[model samples]
Target chain A: MNPTACILVIGNEILSGRTQDVNVQYIARRLAELGITLAEVRIIPDRRPVIVDTIVAARAAFDHVFTTGGIGPTHDDITAPCVAEAFGLPWVIHPETFRLLEAHFPQGEFNAARQRMATLPQGAVPIPNPVSSAPGFSIGNVHVLAGVPRIMRAMFEELAPSLRHGTPVASQSWHALGLYEGALAAGLTDIQERFPGLDIGSYPFRRPDGRGGVTLVSKGLDPAQVRAAADAVQALIAQLGCTPIEGEPPP
Target chain B: MNPTACILVIGNEILSGRTQDVNVQYIARRLAELGITLAEVRIIPDRRPVIVDTIVAARAAFDHVFTTGGIGPTHDDITAPCVAEAFGLPWVIHPETFRLLEAHFPQGEFNAARQRMATLPQGAVPIPNPVSSAPGFSIGNVHVLAGVPRIMRAMFEELAPSLRHGTPVASQSWHALGLYEGALAAGLTDIQERFPGLDIGSYPFRRPDGRGGVTLVSKGLDPAQVRAAADAVQALIAQLGCTPIEGEPPP
Candidate 1:
């Protein structure tokens, strides 16, 4: 089984629709490439108790838990301390983190608020931030990173090598124009049952010009099974009187 | 208190990063306009037990629950039955939904799979889908919509009038160039304490030209409080030796 991961997006900006989340998709794609199954994603607020509860619950459920946002210098940046409380560990300022931030800022510029970023859960290792000096941290199975897309990507790239990988999933897609999903569903169900190990999905789309179609996708760890399922789906589409296209049809 | 809502995005495509979700932001913005607070969002896979569990938990936690996806004709479309199980109600085909689908599809095209879209939990009312004839259902406070962005938006717009609204939230924003969030954090904290009713957020951004800045946003139901907090934030930015700009800075 692939090592499973869950993402906790922590922020009020996202919940309020003030900010569109770019981190979930970035993390999900990267995890897929690393052969990790991205199981779930939760967009939560900056509430401490809720953060702690989600962290504890996610850690217990998945092999890896990634949290983004609330690790900055502001008063609302409470992720590090909350994470410490969740694990029942002491919130301590890491000497190395302090030194890095100290060097990054000019003399007499590092204030109390800046120093807050240096503090992290006990025994947590710093996740480097190439974009900004303020680093994220990883403790146990939880990796806490920045909410900003650029900084989050940098931190993830730095820490990704340390995560354990499983078998990378392979996927194939077949599309058919003028094919209603209702016509394809029964055959698709039969194909899915025949290849229990593979996951088959039927997505329907209607173009602006009023042309509509269905796209069938097959995904699995076994490349051969995915390919076989894709072939079957293509045949099914042809049998339904629609020519099967190799990739997604233009919307 | 504002009416609170939670969005449940049920799809393996989202978890696998094959599709970027456009529904959450749309729902969030629409709900905000309707004076409803979007509290949280969860993206889960096409699993039966997980879907049912999340539905039950979310229903118990919030005033409204909006679920997107898994209401199609395919085998993976199990949300209706799972929602029925969650409510301990019998899953049955709604006659109106069946009539609509039957009328929409061409003669002899309304197969068994097409009829599946008519199924709903007992005591549920159908939410019309203008984009697609396959109607979504609202059982109790849970409004089950489509995963497709166009269809989802249409369903939401139709249902928005029926939902109860609260006081619409008001917001103000101040931006400062070349201002580090660390330098402003302490003052922001003081302002936050003084204006406890307003939610203040500090977001930092780096421009493509390498200049960085911070944007402070104040949000609340009270417009006067939001404006007052924004003024204080601007003053704090000026005190830090940076000119505060209203609204977002040019990228």
Candidate 2:
């Protein structure tokens, strides 16, 4: 199995419903592509105490923890220092980060506002920022990145190569019309019991044509296990006398 | 202040980057408008244990807790029962909710999957779902709502008329152009200490012309206190020879 990971999304804008949290989905998809299991996610505000507590907890709980938001120069951006304090490290300006910031501006005539971006917690490694000069950093198992999805994505792309891969993820899903979740509940449970390593999920859908069905999803590191579980689901649907659709249409 | 609240966003799709968490931001903005202090937000997966633990923790910690997602009829939607387990309530069909469901699909002939939507924990009050027949419920201070933003928003709208409103929210803000965070640190700290009741926040802005500035925000129930603190901030900015923008523009 791939190692477990957790995501901590920090922003009052997200909690207050002003801005939707797009970065969590981006991170999950990326981690899946990299064969990592996203086990948990927590959305928190930019408050220093809460951020510090959650980050510390996630660090101890998960193999890898990724935090998004509050890394900017804004007053709401407290992730950097809060993270530093969590690990009992002093917040200091990193020389290399300053170099990157200096390159962005000419004559190295650094504005103090711009210099704020170079500040890092003591003993942290800078995560390259391809889109913006304001780089993210990593301390221990925690990867703190920008909340902006575009910049965060670019940073992840740069960082992915160096990270260790555990197991490659694979999934197979089947869907059909005129099927109820409860009717297939017994069979699905049986299939899950048979394929212990596979994670099976049932999602019901309502089509525009007023038809409804449940989509059976089987996911695991072993392609054979997922395929076997999916095949069993199809066979169970056939036994239930429903016209079994081979698989859900690709998104 | 009209009692504080926290929103917990639950879904794996959100963390996996497949879905965006729009509910948290919406709830926060609404609470702010209603003079309710939105303190924190936590997003977790569909996992039962995590859901139960989060609900339990939030209930003990916050005045009112709002949860979004995992209340649908699908198999993965286990939020309702998990909440029941968290609070030690028996999982039973709520009569009012059943009546609402029956009104929509009178004969239970709609589909077994549709009937699945009516299952509620015993002793839960139907929050009323205007958009859909699946009723959200409230047990104690925890308001469990749907994941769909449209339905959740509507449900809250229906529940709002009955909720108790306290003091109106008051806020004052001043924008300082191209002022570094460190340079204004002492002054901001003094302002915060001078106004104990006001929730002072500093928000930095990246100007379109490539300049940086911080907007200091203070929120409180006392209009006089808010005004005095805001005036002090405005005066401090003027003393520093930093131009303070007049009035709050479109955020």
Candidate 3:
């Protein structure tokens, strides 16, 4: 069984549509490589109550939970304290974090606002940021991360080694132009039913020039089963008078 | 108060890292323009129980609930039936949708698999799809749309005017190069406190060349308050000895 994970994007920017979020897709891909099932992804506001409640719920529900945004120096950056409140722990200044931050900043420049970055939940473990000096942290199952894509990527790559590994899911696909999903659905169902373990999917897409295509995918932990299902789908598409093109359609 | 909305993206492709989803951003911007607050966004897999439960919960929690994906002919496309189960209504074929889809296909091509596209929850109002004839539907507050970005955009635009409009939220931003967040955090907090109605945000970004900057935004329904907050942010940036650039930083 794959260890399930959830990503909580605690940013008003994304929810407001002011920002295009690339963090979720980046983390989702990383988790797949690590064999952790990306079960859920949420983009939520920086509201304290929402963050606290979601953190508590997500931690209890999934094997791992990652949160991006709200760990900055600004007032909206309330995630660290909210996480502490959720865990029923003291929001304290870690000596090492405080010292590292204090030393990094120029003399007398690390004001009370910058010091907020040093304060974390009592039991939190700092996830180092190579892009910026400010560190994200983890408390139990929830990993706090930066909202910026570059910083978030650095933090996750640093913290990823600590997460539990599961069986890696492999995928095989066959796609073809002029292949309607309705025409392929029946044969696809038969393939799925025959190999119950593999998840067979039919995705229809229309190209820019008004050409339509369908991509048939077989995905599972077992590579052999996925490959076999892909073969069946390829044959099925050929039977429908469309030439099967292996792999995903071009962007 | 603006009407609140939650967008549910139900797709294994998104979770599996096989696809990057643009549907959420597109819907979120539209909802904002319609004076609706996009409070939350969830990306869940193509699972029956999860879809039904999420639909029930989201519809009850938000004023409008929009779902994308899994309304296709494939076996994994269980959204339509699950929506019916959530509302405690029977899933039945809609006569108008059936007629349109049947006519769209050639003779005998409207098989059982293709006919599934015509199925809808009891009392569903079909939302016309200009890109593809297979119509999406709105049952209660939950509007079920397609996963495909092009089709979803067409469907949402057709159905957008029917949504209840609140005070449209507008935004004003001030950004500048080499402006660090810690330097702006204090004054930004004061600005936020002064204009409690406006949502003040401070976002830091690092360019590919390693040049860092900050974008400060003030958003709210009141144009005067939003503008005042933006002005204050501009002044705050100047106070830190940096020239303030009006509007958001360039991508």
Residue-level lDDT of model 3, residues B85-198, one tens digit each, is 999999998999999999998999999998999999989999999977998999889999999988999999889989888988888888868978888888989999999988
* TM-score of every candidate's chain A: 0.96, 0.93, 0.96
Give the candidate order by descending TM-score.
3, 1, 2
- Residue B41 C-alpha lDDT in model 2: 75
Q: Model 3 Cα displacement at B239 (Å)?
A: 1.2
User: How does the DockQ of candidate 2 come out?
Assistant: 0.40
TM-scores, one per candidate: 0.97, 0.81, 0.97
> Which residue pairs show collisions in model 3?
none
True contacts kept of 3: 0.74
lDDT score at residue A234, model 3, on the 0-100 scale: 83
Kept native contacts, as fractions per model, are: 0.73, 0.57, 0.74
TM-score of chain B of each: 0.96, 0.89, 0.97
C-alpha root-mean-square deviation, each candidate: 1.6, 4.5, 1.4
Docking class of 1: medium
Model 2, stretches more than 4 Å misplaced? A107-109, A175-196, A204-214, A234-251, B99-103, B106-116, B167-251
Given candidate 3, what's the lDDT at residue A69? 93
Show how many residue pairs clash in every candidate, following the order shown: 0, 16, 0
TM-score, candidate 3, chain B alone = 0.97
